[model samples]
Target: MFYPLRERISTWTTSQQTAEEETELIQRKRIQDLPLLRAAKENDIHLLKQLLEDKNCDPFQRGAVGETALHVAVQHENLEAAEILLDEAPQLINQPMTSDLYQGEHILTFAACVGDIEIVKILLDHGANLHAKDSWGNTILHILVLQPSKSLLCQMLDFLLSKDGGKTLIDIPNARGLTPLKMAASEGNVTMFQHLIQKKRKIQWTYGPAATMMYDISECDSMEDHKSVLELIATSSKSQAHKILNVPPVKELLQKKWQNVGRPYTWFLTAVYILYMICVSLCCAHRPLKPREDNVTNQRDITIYVQKTLKEAYLSGDDRLRLVGEIISVVGAFILLLSELSQAYIFGLKYFISHNFWRDPFNIIRICYSCMILVILGMRLTDADGEVVPMSAALVLGWCYIMYFARGFQMLGPFTIIIRKMAASDLLKFCWLMAVVVCGYSLALYVTFQTVDPQALGAFYSYTMTLISTYCLFSNLLNGPANYTIDNPAMYSPLYSSFCVIAFLLMFNLLIAMMGDTQSAMAKKKEELWKAEISGATVKMEQTFPKSHWFCSESSGNDFKETRYISLEEKKWHPFHLEEASGSSSDDESDEDVPPQNSQERNPNLDPYQEIREDITDRAEDRGNVDHNDNEIWEEELFEF
Candidate 1:
């Protein structure tokens, strides 16, 4: 047993020596890497070359935090040094570069994040894996699209897509499950979104049936956001929402959404609307009255009396506590006004004017609400009647307050469409028809009876009397117009008898039929109508507010910025077609839409950059702007662009 233990002890000693020696070598290599790491960070190409030439030097070696020399080259934006390193040892292309700032980030991801096109191109040319992700499973394309930088975004997309021969490379999702297209939509960046659309068309990529993938549902922080996202997806160019999800009426549903409301900047407008409404309601609630014991009081006493009157009105009015209700109502109205004004500005002067701006039902209601407040204040100035609440104004305010629940109904989805159809469409039409028919009957009946009975309708053909008489003719208002027969036999004209029969038989029945048909038609196709409304709303929202900054802007870094902006002049997204981009003929029937897997590889002559040069060269020659050398410079700069 002692002899066996001696053997085990000898083996243990040997293993310990090996372990010690390995630790020493690790420490030595790390010490040696210090110079190489320094050279890489400083972009000293000569030092980098010298370091690599040493037989013991390992370019593949990780620094203390797993960053390779290539990662250093990318991290510092050292294109020249990166080139030399990549050239001398091309295998350094796909290093697992990690650092404190960019922990576990691959070299490709680092290059893309910097918006360094040339470095990205060089890395791609050297077979760097575009598919490789960082710790977050986000590819370089995912990082590039985090913000709206058309130049970097388009080029990076063009390069990867061209290399991959299609959209499959760029379609990779991030840790949050957002694909590049959905990310673009989420930001509401039109230019970048259009680029992605063009790429989709270039690849002829028909999106699959996964509507959830097309739009990130969880990105919607509110009901408004969800509605907007649904709309954006529905109306998008590659939107398979029509064929795949095939929801109907996408546009109408979105008209009420808060697409541009999430930004903190717009919250001020909402606050204003709320405040203005509150002030209006307070002013209308109660007015200051004269002191009861007015025996030639001093100015201070008058002031005190005025203050007390206002204070009581502001606190509680008529024992119903209407002061609190009035204050809240006016605040909401103020909020409504501010919101409307902001909407007008966002909609633009031309759009607002052309749309007959005030025709909106909300605008009409606002006008009536404002008018009632004004009239009440105006009447207050006269001693004849202090604080005569304009019944019309009070009535409108009552409706506006009650309609608060209606605003909350937007969250009900398809049912919201039904409500809108009933309130905005059917109700308006019914009111218009009623106004024409009722006014005609009111005029005829009032003219016939007013001369004979002066107080025939009890108010001598005043608006109130005429309205009451009109209602009486439709049905007996407590045996209404029939009471006139007891006073005088002449009250029954054949014309009056015919008018009552026609009004009840034809007008009421017609109104009922029209309203029924409208409601039934919508109910029959409620699902399709709701979807269509949502889709239209999604598309139209972008049309209305192109500058709306969506939520994805939160994660955007220096990596996703405009290194080279595609000018409005260059217009061409692809060398061939600013025309197609303009929705013109170039987009019409492209043979290249169905290109094969190796189309770009097979056609070296079809380089879009080269095509752009030829077009610019021809244009420059035509304008006599500069000789061939300047043209060459311009062409070179264009390629850089």
Candidate 2:
């Protein structure tokens, strides 16, 4: 009894498992019938209807190719059949056909290729994905060209183009890298070829096999097609292909313009030299001195001592005076040269720094010169005996500065415009200019004291200390470390007051204004150069016209010939001599021909030439009626010439 019960349980389990397996197999068969049902392929539809009518049938079936019944109907050029199936079961249209197997030959691809415009419209209306690429990466347009019907292909293209068109067909390449246009050319489809040519006028035949294939197609039937191909090939080979391609012409033009502008190395040097000279002049202009006593006793004592000292240490001849003058001039010139060299170096350094060179040669030279000058000043200030004054060092540094300035000036000779403009300006460029002047003045005071009394090194040292303190005050003011007010009451002494006033009015104002003016002028010149560059670019662009074949057609050529102008001007293009060509005389023309004259031409009393004379007279009368303020109008008229 137990064995019978176990056998019965096993039999029931086996039966249930068989039923589930059968159901799965039936579902799989229904899925496989989907593409056939969609394509309206008769046999597939019969099988689908049979499955649907039966209680065990699956209406939502997909085929081996992952295509549903609707996909098959659309693909098989059966739009009516698809519509019937969709009306019966609307959800089927929304299902995405599996793309794994069919590649570039999906349902929509089939519809587009087969010229089933109605089916495509229905699918699109049902929210079919237009941008969907097939397994082989072919778009609807790509599939359309594969069809034989030219009219249908054109219709499909027009429909796709109607919404957000002007996209390049060349972007879609087949497995072999052949564009749709190239494929059309290969198939000797003149209509498709011409359509693509018109659309993308600048399209080139660069793909090797595709180009050869195009040539082969053109040669298949007649020499005329071959000639057309040859002509296209010839045009592609020409240098004007770049122009035809509509590429900008400014880059090449700019390169040529820069070459013509020449090198700016020399101008850089000149600017440096001028700056150096100004610095030296500023340095030499003022010197620190001890206050002189005016009282009778002190004056008599000082005078007697100075006279005895001068008598003992006097130079014998004009040679010393001449030598001194020469040295001063040399020093001044050296300072000028150094300033100019530094400026030139600054300008050149801009270009060099772009290439990652951080060190500027001119700046280094300036720093060295500054250091040397400081050393000399230190020696003069510290040495009680004045035995190690480093006169040779001072002279050497001065001469070096001069040589640098000269070299800079020579380099900048070609930029005469820049130099003259800068020199005439009131811009203060170099801070060192003032520093040098102050130092030179301090040194001069030391020299003067030495001349007065050969053993006055201590007095000279005190004066140098005062000069250093004054320089420090100026430096603090410039650096904004301290306010520029003269807080030190000692600076209010009559001697210091006069020097400060002179320095402010003469040196500082003049130098600053000159530098400002120079900068403005240089900026203006650069602007002019930029304008010239733009103009050159415009001219280059004009010369590169005729890139678009549409603009080079027979009608365009004729229009160009008639106008004799490169750019289209509406007023110029308006036809003249219309009445004469129509054989109509002025008298014979009705009121319609003349119409009513506008306000500008309504004066009937004025003859053609008399009207012109009257206009001039009216303008003169208007001028005569104007009021003058401070004789401003008269001055303007006088200067009009």
Candidate 3:
């Protein structure tokens, strides 16, 4: 034991010496990088200038952490020192860090990450490359995107927009294949996405064909990111989402993708749900018939009736079909439930429930019908014959769930959206108001009638009469109170009539106004609402597909770039065809539906020199007219750095 302890002590001694050696090496490097860099890091402006001018010290020399004097000044947030260093050695502005931790990071990257507008401007004025990349291939824009401060982010974005070629920087993806827009979307950074869109909106005209010189769509790298971007676009209320969705290229791509992938998946889901509905109907309709009391006169008659009922309920062909249908419905419900659970897991529980799930009338109906089916199944399993009420309600909800299929059609989609909105908002509020009125009036009538005939008046009779009469008032039957039986019709009739007229006029007019407002609001945004619905459906259907089918890989050849290339001008509608439609032209058709995996590609017909010259010209134009209308609309809780 003593010998082993001695050996361990010797090993510790050797390791300690190694650590000391490394420390000494770093200390020596700091010393060697001293004076100029040290002055900058310490914010000694006078010393920095003295060393730069008097001793002619090289400000470009890097320190232990691979930082030059300018880099050190930026990291320390010493603006004066940074300006001095840049003035002495302009080449130092774009010199990247040579150390492993910050290799390829220039002074501009530091300024961007530091959230200093002055330093950024100074560096750019000193001829710093705005497009320089860090070790991870993140540009200045990417670095700026990772900054935590929104005000600084806005300032930087504004400054960049004022610069030439700033808009084009947004479309450039880093090594990870994430453009600034896609990056913001992937991280759920709504404000960044909105600001970026505001800048893009000035240049990107949505109604026109996709002008490559101005804007281009970014593709998702993986299925997970694809799902995330789709989620952001679908649930966000920003007009930017609408703008991006309505881009002609995006619309065409979605249409092609829906036709190829979403259509078949939707059809399969529809068939399964339809089958489930049929089975539900069969199970409810084929329940055992109740025996008539008039026929059950004696023991022999009762016994005969019991045998016949048993034969019809359990042994007949319809009863067999009912059993099979129950099993099939259970399986279908289980499959749909699993689908929902997987979506919840993918998008998180809060999003799955709150965003669009509970608001959807179809989902609500499906849930109600499913719960009723489960209750019916449980009661049937116990050999109980009291599933009538649940079965009836379930049958009704099952039929109402057909509205889910309406979302696929453009005409039906907007209408369903309007109905859903009205029901949730206007109708729900109306019901609440009506509940208040009905409760108050019922209490008053109850008090009035109870005094007239305490023994004759049931506890709920006033409530029943009040509710029925109110409904009749809505239906325009003014004399509905006359049909009700009461201890004293005169006393009850006056109060009932007064309640009906007042409640009907107040509630119905308010409801009509509210519904009209809802209809008008939805009508104003009908196109946007319909597109959002279509995009949502497409995304949901996409999630059902396997990962192997996703287009995550890069394209091998230099095909046409961007999502799709339409003509520069919009095609005018005419009665006759202007050009011959070619069914066999694979090259022309390929450019329409097929999106390039690579974001950048060259047009073969355009001269490279001319294209570059035109691009330079376009970049030089002023971009001061950015739309800032969405600033107040977007939420301020942006992504963390």
The alpha-carbon deviation from the true structure for residue 194 of candidate 3, after best TM-score superposition, in angstroms, is 12
Clash count (model 3, backbone only): 0
Clashes of 1: 25
Clashes of each: 25, 49, 0
Question: Stretches of candidate 1 above 4 Å error?
Answer: 1-331, 353-360, 374-416, 455-464, 471-479, 484-493, 524-641
Minimum summed lDDT over a 10-residue window in model 3 is located at: 632-641
lDDT by residue for model 2 over 403-507, one digit each (tens)? 323322324322433443453332224454676666765555444444343333233446766476457544444221222342322323443444466456666
TM-score of 2: 0.26
Query: How do the residues 408-492 of candidate 1 rate in per-residue lDDT, one tens digit apiece?
Result: 2234445555655566776777667767766776776666566665544453256567766676666555343444343633644
- Global lDDT of each candidate: 0.55, 0.45, 0.64
> TM-score of model 3 relative to the true fold?
0.58
- lDDT string, candidate 3, 1-641, tens digits: 67898899999999889877875588456845588877887889888878989655666676776777788789879999988888877888768888744578777878877878888888888888877777777777777666667566877777765664534676677887767776665454556665774454323222212232222233421223453345556666565465555554445546555555555666666787787787778766656665554555565353322112334466767678677877887776666566667767887989878764766666667667777878877776676655777888887877777777776767687888898899888898888777777667666665665545543544325667656655555556644433246446455677767776777677688889999999998898887777777767767656656646634322211123233222223332435543445333465566556545422254555554665545534443423444343222211311110
Q: Cα lDDT for residue 60, model 2?
A: 66
- Candidate 2: regions farther than 4 A off: 1-55, 60-67, 87-104, 164-170, 201-641
lDDT of 3: 0.64
All candidates: TM-score: 0.39, 0.26, 0.58
